[model samples]
Target: MFFFMAKKDRDYFLSFIAIVFLILHLHVSANEEADRIISLPGQPKVAFQQFSGYVTVNEVAGRALFYWLTEAVQQPSSKPLVVWLNGGPGCSSVAYGASEEIGPFRISKTTSGLYLNKFSWNKLANLLFLETPAGVGFSYSNRSSDLFDTGDIRTAKDSLQFLIRWLDRFPRYKNREVYLTGESYAGHYVPQLARQIVNYNANTNHKINFKGFMVGNAVTDNYYDNLGTVNYWWSHAMISDKTYKQLMSTCDFQRQKESNECESLYYYAMDQEFGNIDQYNIYAPPCNNSDGSSATRHNMRLPHRPHSAVQLYSGYDPCTEKYAEIYYNRPDVQKALHANISGHIPYKWTACSETLNRNWNDTDSSILPIYRELIAAGLRIWVFSGDVDAVVPVTATRYSLAQLKLDTTISWYPWYVKKQVGGWTEVYKGLTFATVRGAGHEVPVFKPRAAFQLFSSFLQGKPLPKS
Candidate 1:
């Protein structure tokens, strides 16, 4: 059996040969896969076709390693460049950005029409799709193994390395305003990466132009984000009120040690399993405890294990060909699976597989303070939320932000697109928070109109869309 180092245990001083097994392949320039600088077919809409670049860093064994992205064409002044990362701590941003979110296309739910989004965000911002952390998708390492969860520090290091090199590859945009954005657990990813940029600017003599950040349905604070969000989800009718009140009273939000086997009322309620999830036999989206039902809010619990990972990702190949290219079964993705690593290590289930169950460290020492630090340093911070997600619901986001206590008065307004009110906006303390009404965890997939308006505001560092 192959053994690997937990990120916490890795000794930087280990012998190079002992770490050689971690080098899955040596990345000599000749052997490295050059990134595809895509062209948007010179359509009347495009000023330029596309640009692409890669960030190369050394493997744990000191071998060359790389991650890259394709930047869709954009009008320099009219459009801002937005780098989007999806938070699996392992999932590829490109898979989510291109396949699901607003990068000019989307999957047809019914199969007849192409289901054009009519509100793609990239039309307003130059979209860049990144495959990060070296093992998520086309991203691979010559390194035979990776520390599971890899933690926030390593993710930040890799992302900073990626940003510095990516800027080097496309210097024309060096001065162009850049925004860091993502969804799901990216509550941490966006800020963590942003913190690095802020730190680099403060600590080093170098200057890589960075503008601001945006996070949707994110995991902000472990206690408030995880436990409080669940409670707020119930209050919003996504779950039962009784379940929430009970959880608030009995369930300790801080420790948040959830498990399926636990007999706590919290577990008993979420353990709800319908024999099948067919519409006729559906468990109604929970409402307040007053709704006629045996289930209570106390019954709602974060899924014990991540949605699909704890159950199974094996033998499941979802329909992806309908969208872009289906690379789920590719030999390259299959080869990078660290099965020998703990089951805690994740693999894609469908494309967005690493949602709930993640070995990530959600403790307090993360980028929270760094966000305040950045705000103090004059960085523009925008926190956006998708109202539909029960997990990481917007209310929980509100709870966390209220704590920041920024000096700017919160502005309640609406963002308009095509002259129609698209979403709600609040700007405070040099930070703006927007809520996409119809959207879920992945906002672009559900609310592209608001997404575009957002990037437009993001690039300009303006307030969020007016509702």
Candidate 2:
């Protein structure tokens, strides 16, 4: 062991080691910042970083899910990850959740620009909006059959895969506390995905650190949803007494198929109940140019251009959806957002794909059982409703929660935001129920400040402010 090393040779070895370490560090930094959005058309100046791209979930089918992520306003590294999904069972989360709802900006009325939402949920957490299940929005599958072959089970599985692959791409968020949140038919989506995450953690040591899930104006049970909808319509005087009576006497919501007599009465009742109004928010004025067509077009469909646009109460514009469509479909905007690069999709992007909606294959009768299981598993579950939403009204959610029969931890009480009564809230042993006053089915789009308040509380696992 008496070898003498030359000084130049030793120095050369040390320098090589330093260069190698520096290159490795740079590589990690580059990967961390991959897919960063340098700028977007009509976007205002902001300090937080934004990202958008696709994560392939299935290779054989060339299936991918698209996501738009906004880091927290200040210290993004310390914030939790919150993923938002919009439910039509076929709607676009990027269109609704990112553009029109709680995302950082709202599409401007002019259809050529955007404006910052002062109450964006990204202020509190890293917000991720996903266009899921391979057929909605910019997400697509190479196998054409994959478009129509989707349901709760397939959706959950693919979403889980998306999360896994997405984290691989941006590993910084791999260990962060994750919250799965959605609304409407996401009543089915959020719970199912959480269950899958739980199973995933149990089998492998790879934990996603899933904290909980929250849904607003969700569809938990068809029977209660239908019953409560009729009751809400009748109580609110949206339907005639005879129509309400007929709906109650003839319809059996629990059954998969209804009798001919029931269908006739149901259709008649719906005709009177909806008419030319926006069923999403019963009291809110209908979009002027909208013909108020079928349930698929009015209640579940994404906003699109009509012959003309109308103004709603306050600064809210009913034509925002049209603006969103115009803004996103721009060739330059797609390049900026890094969308449609793979050519898996054949046509231009739309807010909600009619093809996807028509092809959607699964409709579960109830997601209530999943709720019971998740609550028993000690997951933080919060379900909020926009009181004015006739489609999935507060009454409907109330009836569905009643089926759970969880012991009440806090009695019903008013919750406040900015010194005003925001809504009502109740706490159960493992779940919480809340309502957003004057909000619609898409609560954030109608009452953003209140929705932000609700969302901040949910992420912090804190009760809504009671005053």
Candidate 3:
């Protein structure tokens, strides 16, 4: 089947191929341009470029995941790309991660304005906040069943698809060094997504530059998490000794099904014993009404209670998520961010989807196996905990990491920030573990300076400051 072609004919064929590539390049550039954000509603002027849009992951299901990318403020081209997810199994990264924790802006009280976050993570790397699982925040699937059909596997698969298509839309970042980070239940999402990216890289010729991943106050192993959580409550004096002993005996962490006794005892610990304090931050005040009942809780769900949207405190708005809900639902805000253009959404925007949370199908009992795989692959991994968070406290993280049986590379020591003890750290052979002093479940929201320092250290592949 071999035939010799004339030089002129070969030259023409090569030129035709080059032209096709050029046309495709232009089309991708146009798509990127369409997603560029000139400015958000009530946003202050900033130097970095921003883009927010949706990348369809499944055409048959009409599923698309929403993303908001904030490039590094200085030397944007040289910085690595960091994908930040917030874990509720059904939470919106845009509302929690972007607006409240690490993204560039904080929603103002009026919910119609924005203010800069001095400790935004974008200062060091490009931050991409994603709303995943097709029903969180602005992401959606036309097939209603898709909303109900979500779990670790589908979420990881859809997120991997989103990254592949997103890289095409912004080709410059296709080969950029990337890191995955998140908090709360994202302990599952971050590791699962990282595993997906690793698998994708193994099979594809074009590999993603995924260096490593880090998680804070993560839910690792069910048995360890439950054990450590009970211990933390008792040790912190949040629960009575009587309740702690009952939890240890009644709750079967190994079983997927919970007995009525365990369920009631768990509720008793949170409601009757723990008082009206913020479980996410034990020392911080709850988002409360005038009647002194709690209005909202983060990540963790409690018994149904009624409360108004009124803020009882002066500073550090605990109702920040409320502001995000108002801001993102505005017509002008959606138009500015290029969201909800199709008018396909039949319901109002919410920070977390209650239906999806209730119906989530499968969850791995432990992610320690995935951790071992990534560590063996020589990818940098880190786990951190906020000491004050009762929901998933430092004790829980320590218990989970212990199951890995990793050899300790560095003895435990206090890490410093600005001449103060920021946290304690221990470097394992394959992973690093650290704690933020007096910080809560949302580390950055409570201890931004220390969180920023820890982030900078992670990106640089260096240990936290020893002095």
Best by TM-score: 3
lDDT of each: 0.55, 0.81, 0.86
Q: In candidate 1, what are the lDDT values of residues 1-467, reduced to their tens digit?
A: 12477554455435555667456333322233344433222112434344333345554533122333334445545556678887655565655666556665444433322333466666666677666655554454454344344456666777788777666555556777788888765677788888888878877776767878877777776566666566654655544666666666675555546543333654544455221121100222321124554221121333222211111012311222222324433333323321112222244324433422355443333345767877877877888887665556777788778777876575687777778767788888767888876666566655566677776777677665444
Say which candidate scores most in lDDT.
3
How many steric clashes between backbone atoms does each model show?
19, 0, 0
Return the clash pairs for model 2, or none.
none
**Ranking of all candidate structures by their lDDT, best first:** 3, 2, 1
Candidate 3 wrongly placed segments (more than 4 Å):
1-21, 298-315
Question: Each prediction's TM-score against the native?
Answer: 0.71, 0.91, 0.94
- lDDT score of model 3? 0.86
Candidate 2 lDDT score relative to the true structure: 0.81
